[model samples]
Target: MDFSTLCVHGCSKRYDTTGSVSVPIFQSATFVHPGVGLSTGFDYSRAQNPTREYLEQTVANLEGGADAIAFSSGMAAITTLMEIFSPGDHIIATDDLYGGSHRLFSHISKKNGLTFDFVDTTDVQNIKKCIRNETRAVFIETPTNPMMHVTDIAAVSKLCRENSLLLVVDNTFLTPYFQRPLQLGADIVVHSGTKYLGGHNDTLAGFIVVSDAALAERLRFLSKTTGACLSPFDSWLLIRGIKTLAVRLERQQQTAFRIAEWLSKQDKIRKVHYPGLPSHPGYEISKKQTSGFGAMLSFETDSKETAHRILERVSIIQYAESLGGVESLITYPMLQTHADIPQQEREARGIGECLLRLSVGLEAADDLIEDLRQAIYGGKANV
Candidate 1:
C-alpha cells in the first residue's frame, strides 16, 4: 500500500466484536486469566497494553522495522536506548541537536559513566576521526535541530558497519512519512512522537524502532523494566495523529519552503538554514535520502536586536518551543533549544544568539509570510 494508505490502515486492528475502526484503549493495569496457571499475552499494563501495542505495531510497520516500542516521552526512549551500553562505552553524536539531548549526553549520561564526542556529522570524516576503540555507537540527527545539518545516513551507516558500531538516527524532524532511517541502514531509529506523529500539541510520546531482532528484544526488555511505556490514551492519540501524517507534512513542508525562500531574501536575515533551499549545504544530500525537506527551519538575523523584535511581535506564528504541530512555532536556539550547550560550544556550532528556528504548520503560506513580514519589518505587505 502507498504511504497515505498505511497512515490510516497499517498494522491497525479492528474490534472483532464491535468492528470498531479505532483501536480501543485497554486501560487496565492488569489482565485476568481464564484458568489456573494460565495467562494472556498481556499480564500487566506496564509490560504491555492493547492500545499501546497497536500503536507500536503501526509505527513499526510505518518505519519498516521489525518492531517498535513507545515511551512516555522522547527523552525516555533515548535514555532507554542508551542503557544498552555500559558505563565505559563512548558515543559519537551530532554537534547541533535538541537542547534536551545535549543536556542528557553532557550532564546526565556522563554522570552515568558514558562519554560522548559531538562532531559535525555532515562530513563523514568528523565521525571517522571521532571513532575511538571504546566508541560503541554513532548517534545522529539529520537536518539537525536549529542548523538543519543533513548527514549522509548511508555513508555513516557504512562507517559504523566497518567499525562494528551501531548507528542510531533520530527521525524526529522528517518522521517515517518523509524519511525512513532504518531503510538507509540505521541500526536503530528513534522519534519524539510528540512532534509530527502527534500532529497536535496535545500529547507527549516517543518511539524506538529497529529491524534487528536481538536489538528489538533488548529494547523491549529495557522498556518493560524501565516502566516508561506510553499511556493508552496517548497511544490512541498518536495513532489518530499518524493517520494524517502524509497530508499534514505535505502542507507543512510546502509552507516551509516558501518561508525559507522569503527569509533568504530579507535584509534583516543573514542566512537561512533549510534543507529544501538549493543554497543550503545539505540540499543535494537531503534530496538523495529523504522524500521531503520537512517543515522545520532556522535562520539568523543581522543582529540579536532584530531577532528579539520578531520574537516579540509575531502574532500568528507563535513564539514558542517545540515543533511539528498544526500551529506554527518560533524558537530561539540560543535561549531555548540549544541553550544547555556551553556558550563557547554553541557558538562554535554556529547556533549564535541571532538564530531562530521555525516549525511551519498547516497555515496558509501567504498568511504566514505576511505575519513574518510584519514581525520583522513592522509594516504591511506592499507586494
Candidate 2:
C-alpha cells in the first residue's frame, strides 16, 4: 500500500475490539485490572491511551521508526527529549532555528547546566569543527526556520556517527511524506505535528520518532514522567488530519512553487527562499535527498516598509503566526517567530525586519498569486 493507505489503515488493528473504521477516543483516565497484579498493557492515560497509541503507531510506521511518542505541544516533545541528557552535556545545533527551540536551549537548558553551540549545519565542516568531548548530540532543523537554510542531513549524520554523537533532526518543515530523516541515518526525528502532520490549525500536537529502541524507551519514560501526553480527543483529531496529509500537501506544494516563482520576478522582492525554485541555494541538495520540496518558504523585500505594507494589506493570506494549515498564512519572522532571539543574533542570522515567511496552503494558485500582487503593489493585477 501507498502513503495514503497507511495514513488511513496503518494502525487499524488497535480498533479491532470495536470493529469500527474510525479509531475511538479512549477518553478514560485509568483502566481496570482483571485480576490481582495483572494488567492490560495500559494502566493510565499519561502512560498510554488507545487513540494516542493508534496515532503514534501509524506515525512511527510512516517515518520508518521503531516507536513514536505524542505530546500536548511541539515544545513539550522537545523538552521531554532534552531530559535524556545529564547536566553539563553539550549539543551542537543549527544556527537558524525556531524561536521556541532557541529559547529552550539558550535559557532553559543552559540554566539546567546543558550547553549548546549554534553553527550553520549546511556546511558539515562547521558542525565537525564544533564537536567536543562533552558534545552528546547534534541537533538540526533542515531548511531552518525563517532563513530556509538547508542542512545535509546524511552528511551531518555521518559526522555524528564518527564522533559517537546522536543525530536529531527536526522534520517539522517537511513531514515524513516529503522527507524521512530516519532513512538518512538520523537517530531520532522530531516534529511540530501541529503544523503539517495535523494539516489544520485547529489542534496542537507534537511527535518524536526514533529508530533505536533504547532511545525510544528513554523518551517514553520521560514523556510519562513529564505527563505532557496528547489528550485522547486531540489524538483523534490528529488521526483525521494525517489521513489527508498526502492530498493536502500535494496541493499546497504545487501552489507554493508557483507563488515562489512569481515572487522571484517581482521588483519589490529582494530575495526568495524556497527549495522548489531553481534559483534557491538548496535546490540541488533538496532534490538529492527529499522526495519533494515542502510548502514552507521565506522571502525579503527591498525595505522594512515594503514588508510591513504587504503583510498589512494581504486579504487572502492572513498575516499570522504558525504555519502548515489548509489556509495560507504570511508571518513577520522578526517580530513573530524569531523575536525571542537577541536583536544582534537575529540580525546576524539574516532574519532581518524585511524578511517574511509564508506557509502556502490549499488555496488556488491564481488567487494566491493575485493576493500577493495586490498586497505588494496596492493595485489590481490586470488579470
Candidate 3:
C-alpha cells in the first residue's frame, strides 16, 4: 500500500466489531479478564490500551519497523531508552541537540554513570575519533535541532554495524513522510509524535520504532515499567493527525522553500540554513537521504537588533517555542532551544543571539514573506 494510504487505513485490524471508521478509544483503566487462565491481550492501561495499540501499529507500519511503543512525551521515550545501557557505558551523540536532550545527557545521564561525547556527526570521521572501548551506542538528530545539520544515516549505520553498536535516529524534523531511518539501517527510530505526527499543538506523544522485534519487546518492557505510555485519548489524536501527514508536510515544505529563498535574498538576513537551497552545506546529502527538505529552517540576522525586531513585530508567524505544527512559529535558539548550554559553548556551536529558527506552516508564501518584510523594515503590522 502507498504510504499515504497506509497512514489512513493502517493495519486494518479492528478491536471492536462496531465497524467504526475512526478507531474507538478504549478509555477503561483495566480490562475485564476473559477467563482465569486466558487473557484478552490487554490487562491494564499502563501495559497497553487498544487505542494506543492501534496507533502504534500504524506508526510502526509508517516507519517500516517490526514494532513500536508509544510514550507520554519524547523525553520520556528517550529516558526509557537510556535504561537499556548499564552503568559505565558510554554513548556518542550529536552536539547540536535539543536543549532538553542536552540537559538529560549532561545532568541526568552523566550523573547516572553513563558518559557521553558530543561531536559533529555530519562527518563520520569525527564520530570515529570519539569512540572508546566503553561506547555502547550512537544517538543523533539528523538535520539537528536549531542548526539544521544533516547526517548521512546510511554511513553512520554502517559504522555502527561494524562496531556491533545500536544506532538511534531522531526522525522528528523530517518525520516518516520525508525519511525513514530504519530503512536506512538504523536500529531504532525516535519521534516527537507531538510534532509532525500529531500535526497540531493539541497533544503530546512519542514513539520508539525498531526493526528487530526483540529490541521492540525490550523497550516495551521498560516503557510499561516506567508508566509513561501515551494516553488513549492522545493516541487517538495522533492517529487522526497522522491521517493528513502527507498533505500537510507537502504544503508546509513548499512554503518553506519559498521563504528560505526569499530570506537568502534579504539584506537583513546574514545566513539562511535550509537544505532545500542549493547553497546549504547539507543540500546534496539531504537530497540523497530524504524525499523532501522538511519545513524547518533557521537563519541569522545581520545583527541582534534585527533579530529582536523581527521576533517582536512578526504578526502572521507566532513568536514562540516548539515547531512542526499547522501554525508557523519563530523562536530564538540562543534563548529558547539551546539555552541550557553555556553562552560561550552555545555560541561556539553556532547558536547565537542573531540566529532564529522558523517552523514554516500552511501559510501562503507571499503573505509570510510580506509579514517578514514589514517586521524587518520596522513597520507596524497594521501598516
Candidate 4:
C-alpha cells in the first residue's frame, strides 16, 4: 500500500466487541493472564500495551525497522539508548545537538560517568579522528537543530560498523516520512514523537526503532525496567497523528520552502539556515540524504533586541520551544531551548542571541510571510 493510503487506514481496525473504527484505548494497566502458566503477550502496561504496541508496530513499519519501543518523552528514549553503555563507555556525537539532549550528555550522563566528545560529524574524517577504543556509539542529528547542518549518515554508519560501535540517529525533524536512517545503516533511529508524529501540540511522546532484534530486546527491557512506557491514550493519539504525517509534512515542507525563500530576501535578516535554500551550506548533502528539505528553519536578526521584538510582534506564530506541529512556532534557542548551556558553548556552536528558529506550519505561504513581514517591520519601528 502507498504511504498516503496507509496513513488513513494503517493499524486501525474495529473489533467484534467495540465495533469502533479507531483503535480502542486499552486503558487497563495490566492484562489478565489465561492461567498460571499462560500469558497473553501483554502482562503489564509498563512492559507493553495493545494501543502502544499498535503505535510501535506502525512506527516500525513506517521506518522499515524490525521493532520499535515507545517512550514517555524524547529524552526518555535517548536515555534508554544511553543505558546500553556503562559508565566508562565513550560516545562520539555531533556538537550542535538538541538542547535537551545536550543537557543529558553534558550533565546527566557525565554525572553517571559516561564520557562524550562532541564533534562536527559532517566531516567523516573528523568523526574518525575522534573515535576511541572505548567509544561505544555515535550519536548524530542531521539537519542539526538551529544550524540545519547535515551529516552523511552512511559515512558515519560505516565508521561505526568498522569499529563495532552503535550508530543512533535522531529523526525527529525529518520523521520517517522524509528520512529513514536505518536504511542509511544507522543502528538505531529515535524520534520525539511529540513533534511531527503527534502533529498536534497536545501530546508528548517518543519512539526508538531498531533493526537488530537483539538490540530491540535490550531496549525493550530497559524501557520496561525504567517504567518510561508511553501512556495508552498518548499512544493512540500518536498513532492517529502519524496517519496524516505524509500529507501534513508535504504541506509543511512546501510552506517552509516558501518561507525560507522569503526570509532570505529580508534586509533585516542576517542569514537564513534552511536546507531548501540553494545557498544553505548543507543543501547538497541534504539533497542526497533526505527525501525533502523539511519545515524547520532558523535565521538571525540584526541584533538581540530586534529578535525579541519580532518574536513579540508575531500574532499567528506562537513563541514556544517545541516544533513539528501544525501551528507555527517560534523559539529563541539560546534562551529557551539551549539556555542551560553556558554562553561560551552556545556561541561556539553559532547559536547566537539574535537567532530565531521557526517551525513552519500548514498555513498559507503568503499569509505566513505577511505575518513575518509585519512583525519584523513593526518591531523595528517600535524599537
- Per-candidate Cα lDDT values, in order, are 0.92, 0.92, 0.93, 0.90
lDDT comparing candidate 4 with the true structure: 0.90
Per-residue lDDT of 1-383 in model 2, one digit per residue for the tens?
A: 79888887767456556677788988999999989999887799999988899999999999999999999999999999999999989999999999999999999999999999999988999998998889999999988998888888899988999999999999999999999999999999999999999988999999999999998998999999999999999999999999999899889999999999999999999999998888888889899889999999999999999999999888889999999999999999889988989999999999999999999989889999998999899986534
Across 1-383, the per-residue lDDT of candidate 1 in tens digits comes to 89899889858565347878777887789999878989777789999988898899999999999999999999999999988999999999998888899899989899999999998899999999999889999999998987999999999999999999999999999999999999999999999999999999999999999999999999999999989999999999999999999999999999999999999999999999999999888999999999999999999999998999999988888998899999999999889888778999999989888999999999899999999999899986433
Model 3 scores a TM of 0.98
Q: After superposition, how far is residue 274 of candidate 1 from its true place, in Å?
A: 0.5
Off by over 4 Å in 1: 380-383
Question: How does residue 58 of candidate 2 score in lDDT?
Answer: 93
Against the hidden true structure, what lDDT does model 3 obtain?
A: 0.93
Estimated TM-score for each candidate: 0.98, 0.98, 0.98, 0.97
Tell me which of candidates 3 and 4 scores higher on TM-score. Answer: 3
Question: Candidate 2 regions off by >4 Å?
Answer: 380-383
**Candidate 4's residue-wise lDDT over 1-383, tens digit each?**
77777666665534237667788889989989999989888899999888888888888888889999999999999988889999899999999999999999999998999999999988999889988888999999998997899999998989899999999999999998889999999999999999999999989999999999998999889999999899999998997998899999999999999898888888999999998888987888888888999999999999888898889888888899899999999999998989988999999998988999999988788778888988988743211
In model 3, the worst 10-residue window by lDDT is 374-383
Q: Which runs in model 4 stand beyond 4 Å of their true positions?
A: 12-18, 379-383
Deviation from native of the Cα of residue 196 in model 4, angstroms: 0.3
